[model samples]
Target chain A: MIGVNSSPPLPIDYLYNFAKELFIHSGYVYFPLLFDPDVEKELKASGLCSRQHVEIENSSSNILLRDRESWFVKGMSLESFVSSYEKLAPESYNQHLEALYKELPFLSSIDDNPITDKLCTIILEILPYFVSKNRRHERKKLTRDEVLELVSEKLNIPPVLPEHARRILNIEKLRVALNSLSKARPTCSKLPSGIVSKTEFEHWFSESLKAEIIKNERRKIKRSIASREKFARINEKVLAVLFFAAEKGSLEIEGFGFFATEHEGEFIIYKRTGEYALKDYYGRIYMFPDCRVAIRTNGTLDPFVIENYKHPFLQKHAPGQKICMRNTLLPSTFTAQNAIFAIQEGISALLYGYKYRKRNGYHSLDSIPMPGSTVTFDDYMVPKDHPRILRGEVLVTNEFR
Target chain B: MNLLDKIKKAREKGKASIGVNSLNTVIAIIEAYSLDSNFLRFLDASPYLIVERKNTGSRFTRKPDLRIPIFPLTSRRNYLLAKQVIEAIGNPYIRFSRAPEEVYLSKFLYRENPSISHDELRNYHFEILLRREIDKKKSKNRFQ
Candidate 1:
C-alpha cells in the first residue's frame, strides 16, 4: 500500500530518510549512489550518472585503476539523483519513502515534498562550506569544469565528461515561501525590530500585511472586512504614523492610544480592551490599555498600531468610502492643546463637511456655502475682513512641528 | 546662477522628480474623472494645471517653475484640475522603479481599485484598471 501510516521499515526507506535528513540539516537534498568498480564498465555503458571522471588516488594508479570502480555520492547533483532513482521500481521507491518517514522521527510527520524542494533551493544559494574533520573551507559550488579540473589535477587524468548543472533555487520564490511560513507560525515575527527604517517603513508595512500571523477571531475579522481592502490602507497608515512618531519622538494614533517611540524594524499592535491580543508582523503579542505603553513584553510600544491596523478608522478611510474626506487634514503634532484642537477640527470637518482646497493663483476668493463655525488652529489668525470665517480657503500650517 | 537658471538646472537634473505630492494629484484626477468623464476632456483642454500634496503638516509650496502645482484636493474643482494634470503624464507611479516608493504611492490605488494586482509592483494593467474603475463608478452613479 502507498499509505505511509501502515508501512513497515525497509532498508531503502532508511536510506531515503537519511538523505532527506541531510537535506533538512545541511540544506541540501542528495542521494547515496553506490558505484562498484567491478561493474563500473557495465554501469558506464548503461548511461546512468553519465557525467564525470572518478579519480582513483593512489601511488600505484595502474593497480588501483584495474580494481573494480567504487564511487560514492557526496555532493549535490539533482539531475544525477533523479536519473539514478528513475531506474528504481516505483513500488520500491514508494516503500523507501514510507520507510524513510518511519525511520526519521523529525520528518516522520511531514507529508509535504514541497518543503524539501524549498530547502534544496535555499541550500544552493546559502550553501554551507564543504567541511573536513581537520579544516574549514569556504562555502561555494564548483562548476563541472572546476570539479573536473580539481579531480584531474589530483589524479592526473584527462577531462572529458558532461556533469549536470547544479540545481538553482529562485531566491525570490524562496523569500516569498519563507515569508508565508513565518506568517503561519504562531510565535514568529516576519519583520523583527532593528531592520526597518523611516524610508523603508512603507515597503516593510506592505510585506508585514502579507506576512503577519492572525489567529481565531482576528481571521474572522479579516474575512468580514475583506472587501474593505484593509491590508494596503492599514500598512500605509501605520507606516505614516510610525514615520511621524519616529520623527517627533512620540505620536498618538488618533482613536488609538499614544506611542512613545518606534522600534527600528518592528510593526507593532496593541489590542485595546479586546479578548484577543494584538499580533505584529512578527507574531509578537501585546495586550491593549494595560500595556499600551512600552513594556518588556514581546510587544513594544515604541512602534505601535491599533490592533495592528484592524481598527475601523484605518479600514474605513479608503477611496470611495464616505469617510475618505475626513482625512483631509494632516495628523496634528502632539502638543496637548494642539492634539485637542486637531481632534476638534477633525470632528468638525467630518460633521459639517469643511472640505480641503488648493489655493488658486488668483487672490480673489470663490464663495462656497460654509456650513460649520469658523475653525482655526495655532498662529494662523483669522482675517478681520473675513469675520465669522465663512466661505474661504482654510490654509493648513506646520503648527504641530 | 540666476534663480531661473538654478531652477532649470534642477529640473534638468531630474532632482524635482515626482513624489507623493504628484501621486495624490493623480488620484484626485482619476477620482474626479470617475465622478464625471467630462473632467477628462476638461483636463485634455487645459493649458497648465496645479498638483498638490496632502496636508500632512509639512511646508510645501508649488514652485513657480513647475507646471504642476502642489495643493490640497479640497473640492470637486480641485479634482477636475488634478485630472487634467494627471492625463498629461501617463502614469505617475511608473516613474519610480524602487519598490518602497512605488508601494507608498500605489498601495492606495491598489486597495481602492480591486483590479490592480498585488503580486506585481509594476502591473501594466494599472491604467486599464483605473479606467475600468472610473467607468464602473460612473455607471453605478447613473443608476442612482
Candidate 2:
C-alpha cells in the first residue's frame, strides 16, 4: 500500500483528456494552442534521455519552479516568491538541507568553510525562501514562565524551599538529568540535595514527562489516521457506485467520473471610439469542482477527470494561452469527516465570481463551487423487502456487527 | 536468522528464562495449531520447540511436560514456512530479525477487519518480504 500510490508516469495524453473533460464541465472553450516550436523541439530532444533523467526533470520540484518562475515573470515579484515559498514548497527544510550539503559539502560544517562570507551573502539573498520553507505546523513559543511551569508539572515534588523555589529551579540541570534518565542511565546522584535516586521517583517523573510529549504526538497521529479512516468509510458508502468498479478491477483500464459544474470568469475588453477609448469585460464559463472521487484501485492513486468544451469567441486567444494541469495532494487523514471539504472551501473562493461577492450576507449558490452537489450522494441504507431483497422472508439482521 | 537460531542464541545468552508452569500455554498453542492443516504442514516441514515458562507458580508446583531439542530446518521452503507460522503465532519477545512488532500486527488486523481477503493477506506477506528485500539492498548499498 505504501509504494502502490507512489509516483507514477504522467502521460500527457491522459492530462489532455482530463483538461478536455474540465473544459466540458466548466463550459470553457477548448482551444488547443500550438506549443512554441523551439520548446517543442527541446522537449522532443529531451525525450531521448534515460527514464530516470526524465523522472528527475518532471519531478514536483522542477514543475513547481517552472510554475513559480512563470508567475514571477508575468509581473509577480520576489516578494511574492519569498512570502509563498513555504506554501509553494511543502517538503521539509531538512530534505533541502541534505541536498544542499550533498551539493556543497563545505557547507556541512559552519566552523571550517572559507567561503563563509559569500555563503552568508547568498543565503541572505534567499533567506526569505528558507525562512518560509522551514515553517511547518507552527507551535506557540514557550516563555520562561511557561517552561518553568511545564518542568514543575513534570517533576511534581512538594516545595521544600518555599521562598526560593523559582530561584533554585535549574532548568538546564533538570533537562540534562531528565535526558540521561530517559536513556536508562541512573548515574545522576549529584543532585543539589545529595540524594540517591529511587526507582519509584525516577519512574514517576519519567513516565509523566515522557507521556506529555508522547501523548500529544500520538494524539496528532491518531487524529490523522482516524480522519483518513472516516473519509474512506464515508466514501465507501456515499460513492457506492464506484465500489463495483474497484471490486471488478475496471479501474485498471478506465477511470470513473465524479464531478461536473460551471462558474463565471472575468475578461478585459477595450473599446475604441473617435474621441476616446474604454475597456471592460465579463464572461461565464463552465468549471469543475476539485473533489475528485474516482479513486484508482489498481495499485495507483492517480486522479483523473475527462472534459470537453466548445465556444465561438475562444478561438482568437487559442494561439498564446497554454492550459496547465497541476495537482496538489493536500494533507489528508482517514477520519469520519470528509477531507475534501477544506479543499473545496479553498477552491470556492478562487472560482466564485472574480472575488467572492456576498449578496445580502450570502454568496450565489452556484452548483460548481459547492461540493457533494453532483458527485456525492446522501448516506442511504438499503431497506429490507425493497426491490433488491425478496418480499417473502423476514429480515433477520445480526444484532452484533 | 530463523526461529531456531533465535531460540539457540537466546538460550545461550540466558534470555529464554520461561519456566515449567507455563507448559500449559505452550501446549495450548501447539494444540490450537494441530487443528489447522496449514500449521500442521509447517510443523512437519521444520523442527520447533515451544519454550516453556518454568518455576512460574511457587517453584515446587510446576514442571515442564518435556524438553525439546533444537534442530534447523533443512530446506529453505520449510524454513520460510516455519518462520511465517512462528510470526503468525504472535510472540513479540521472539527476537527474530526484522520481525514486526505487536503494534504492527494489531494495526494490520484492525484495518483488515470484518474479514481479511486473500489479497489482504498476500499484501501483508508481500510487505514483510519487500521490507526484507529493501533492507538487504540497503546493506549491500552501504557495503558498496
TM-score of each: 0.15, 0.14
User: Where does model 2 exceed 4 Å of error?
Assistant: A1-220, A228-310, A313-401, B1-144
Error in Å for residue B125 of model 2: 72
Query: CA lDDT of B40 in candidate 2?
Result: 35
List model 1 lDDT by residue over A264-329, tens digit each: 422222212212222222222222122121111123112122222221122231221222223345
The sequence of per-residue lDDT tens digits that candidate 2 reaches over residues A1-401 is 00122244223223232221111111111212212224335545766322332222322223211111111001122233223323343243234435544644433432211112212221222222223322334475544333323323333423232332222222333344334334432232211211112343334323333333333333433443443343344322222222222222221111111121121111111011111111111112222222222211122222222222111111121222211212434333321122223223222222331222231111122223233223211122233334423442222121111
- Assess candidate 2 and give its lDDT: 0.27
Top model number, TM-score: 1
Consecutive 10-residue window with the lowest summed lDDT within model 2 chain A? A269-278
Instruction: Identify the CAPRI category of the predicted complex in candidate 2.
Output: incorrect
TM-score of 2: 0.14
Model 1: lDDT of residue A352: 32
Chain A TM per prediction: 0.16, 0.16
